[model samples]
Target: MAFNGKFELESQENFEELMKSLGLSDEVIEKYKDQGKIIEIAQNGNTFQARYNYGSKVITNDLPFGQESEFVSFTGHRVKALAKLEGENKLVITMEGLTAAMELSGDKMIETLTNGVSTVKKIWKRI
Candidate 1:
């Protein structure tokens, strides 16, 4: 779905570079990059999931029985990971941390929460 990489050597430049590679119009990428949330995604697919901080606030997660749905929308779902807001950390899920979190909310979320240390390991492997 997505290749794991960081454009952090130069946040703005690297963001521009990665966005260009992702086929975004220069105008589109510039909007978000200007705000400094470089790695955010507006959409996703079945094989992949994405995470972004919302308003730098936290939310409680809830779940339903077998909470499966054809569409998992989070517009009103303002929950975000503590570190995501700082942008000092980036999470690129290789296995299923991203997968599990998207599936189960509430207490099951951390099981899907990206492993910060493990993620750094994966990033190191790619670099």
Candidate 2:
């Protein structure tokens, strides 16, 4: 359970561009701009449960490695996703046109989300 911890967002890059590319409106993006994000992850074997707290919203997903599962997107849409572990520290998920990769290093977790047009990278520190 290397990813079992609560992590707080430390920094982000190109977040606004990624939101725009995902079809989110300016108003919606602005509302969440300065909000703090906390991610809680629990891993048991090849299955993982993750909870994302974004100020006013919370999203939880159950991911089973190497299997297709349903996960809610940031845009509030349910999508079919497949998740897999890369080596021992990285979890990569593919859904629709987006790819999300979460990697752990020391007490920090780096999350990269890409949708071809834009990419957002967020660094989270375990708390």
Task: Tell me the tens digit of each residue's lDDT in model 1 across 1-127.
Answer: 1222311111212445544554558777655454423222222222222333334532223222232323222223222221111122222222212222222122121122233322111111111
lDDT of 2 by residue, 8-68 (tens): 9999999999888988899989987667578899987778888877767888999899999
Give the winner by lDDT: 2
**Candidate 2: residue 85 Cα off by (Å):** 0.4
Best by TM-score: 2
Candidate 2 has which clashing residue pairs, if any?
none
* TM agreement with the true structure for every prediction: 0.27, 0.91
Clashing pairs in 1: none
User: Local error of candidate 2 at 105, Å?
Assistant: 1.3
Each prediction's Cα lDDT score?
0.28, 0.88
